[model samples]
Target: MKKKLLPLALAAAVLAGTMAGCGSSSAASSAAHNTAAPAASSSSSAASSTPSAENVTLNFAIWDSNQEKGLRKIADNFEAANPGIKIKINVTGWSDYWTMLEAGATGGSLPDVFWMHSNEIYRYGSNGMLLDLTDRISKSDKFKLSDYPDQLSKIYNISGKQYAVPKDYDTIGLWYNKTLFDKAGLKYPDETWTWDTLYNAAKKLTKNGVYGILTPLHNQEGFYNFIYQNNGKVISDDKKKSGYDDPATIQAMEYYTKFIREKLSPQIFGDKERAEAMENGLCAMGFFGSWNLSGFAENQYMAKNFDVTVLPQGKTRATIFNGLGNAISANTKHPEEAWRFVEYLSTKEAQEEQAKLGVAISAYNGAADLWVSSNKTFHVKSFIDMVKYAVIRPYSNKTTAWEDRAYETLKPCFTGKQTVKQACQNTAKQMNEALAAE
Candidate 1:
């Protein structure tokens, strides 16, 4: 289940060296647009065991650049506390991140420590690519699996061995154009807004070369929320079957794509286009994740015209929620140093610092409020408020394998090439085939 599309020329760069920081220059440029702001560095009082890697530069790879500033500050405190070990942060886009990881995994030179997600964690953990942290976590007084969200912790555990620690959790939010809403005389979206309310707003706002909303062919930030909101699951809870064919799921899909069918949303296909549409005022609203805060905040247009609120509910209140994990390479030369850096990241100090810096919603218990306070530019508390009914982003052992396959089958529905029901039914068939093989 590995994506081996990484160019061979870049494989050498993935090794610890001058070029170890970034894999795809183009992806980096797009991702770096939204990033960190200056914040006070907060140090930990916790102690570390003597490290063998006195001058080792631990390459820490992550996808979102929005977090780089905050994380770098945290790393500075860590280095100040422990003089010898150095942490080099590598920022890459989401797609390139996996390719770089796959290249490193296959070539036995993966980043000493990197980010892991529910979609790909199973492949890495099951393949013996990640260091087992269960014992270390049990031995440490500074870190504990119980300190984080239980669902997030379980995502990185396979067969009772913990491969990673929860870094942060994110839920989708409704990002809307405040300027456009004011012009249209429409009230801002709130917790009371339902699917019907969203559609009505989109219709009212769609006029004079402007879309009321943009829901692309994306899943996590698109129709997936609607499916769960309507009581339709993606993968079954037991991880054995597809729920795409559920009547409720198909109904929700129909409603989600209606904006496009009615020409209220442009047929935006790529991830970058989604953000651009909102930034350029081509669309009045879109669903984005909490991870986008740093980037979105830095964008002047978004800062002036946009504010995020909880996603509009359907049959019930729900949002597609998921968290990232920090994992060490099973093949890393400096295992002790890698664990030390990862341990620091998992500590309460680091997690709260992450929230205070608006990196992401820290998965640590009680850290969400600080994250809410970190950003005053918008009603970010809405991100934390939705936690009550947040659905852990759907997953299974072969999540990545089935997700793209299902997307290929259902993308046509967004373009009006197929009916939503037909697209969903076809997706179910392909998803079940992939799941059965697993």
Candidate 2:
């Protein structure tokens, strides 16, 4: 079985891009948003060859099956180049990935190297459960930290130590079914579109059992967009407060809740909601990350009929772009070999292969265009154009736990079960509690 990364994305809906919450009224605030810096112009530490007689097997886990074939290929190449170090690919669904990782962390049996998300990176790094790779990273001529976008590297740092290397990056977009739009006699969304345009288009598209949009109440993909549009933050610097109660946050929440409040969006529950929405054609548009590209492309039910565009712009055009990092367990016996695996994975060759396979967009510069062209379907080009504005997800040790509470309390606002003010205040109170507990 393929090892999997944790399903934190589906379970709590973490927003992407560091820039998402950094929007400011002044140019300075905007400029304060840090981009991922390019990798340092040096190779990582030299790969020390361990004798073949002492070969050991290491478990590498990830969450997505779409990239299994490509990763297997990568593992094969790593073995061929390294001689005897074997990386056993273990894949699991998102739900089980985190459970297993948490258990592993406690039992001291975590995989030697595993996939890490932006939200949890700080938590793991700060706890000393993950290896500090800053010195190794700086020494590696093949692993220039500056190659990645600025500020991206900062996500993995905690208390002066860096623990993970970025795996890939993804941005959010408005994924729509072309057939649904054509049937409704409406045009597809564009970069110039705004919240008014989105709502109006969704209204026109709603008829019979079909709705114009499918927006989950989860903060990452749903409400976070509105939060950024209206100018809000998820948490404060000291990580002692929640931003849910901010007036801008409330206004953004109100803006997004309109679809469900106005009965323009279908009632949905759990995973079934997403599948039913797509399979039965219940909704024309869905907001999600680029990572969903592979699943939508391979789905027989929706593959040939769908396309994506930049999400409707709010006060300013912004979308969240999140990334995963490859982290080595601090307990691993073969730190050097583990570093080799990570180094090989980050290079342009492996990344390009990933893009060409259409598993997901690669984080390497110049490899994204290959992903857009990998498939001959809808206007995939627009998805790449969105990178210029992509922002990273908020990073904190308690980000996962805090975000869950925030979403749980805010969900009522979307369904009209609670007013925006009550939801925001409750969300803030609950989120602060979670942060405090951490």
Expressed as tens digits, the lDDT of each residue in 214-328 for candidate 1 is 9888787788889999999888989898999999999999998999999999997765455557666889998777776766666566677889999887889998778888999
- Best prediction by TM-score: 1
User: Pairing residues by index, what is the TM-score of model 1?
Assistant: 0.91
Residue-by-residue lDDT tens digits, candidate 2, 324-357: 7789999888887788888878777767877887
Q: What clash count goes with each model?
A: 1, 47
- Cα displacement (Å) at residue 373, model 2: 2.4
Q: How large an RMSD does model 1 have?
A: 6.5
Candidate 1 wrongly placed segments (more than 4 Å): 1-43, 46-53
RMSD of each: 6.5, 8.5
**Which ranges of candidate 2 are over 4 A from the true structure?**
1-53, 237-239, 436-438
lDDT (C-alpha, whole model) for all candidates: 0.79, 0.68
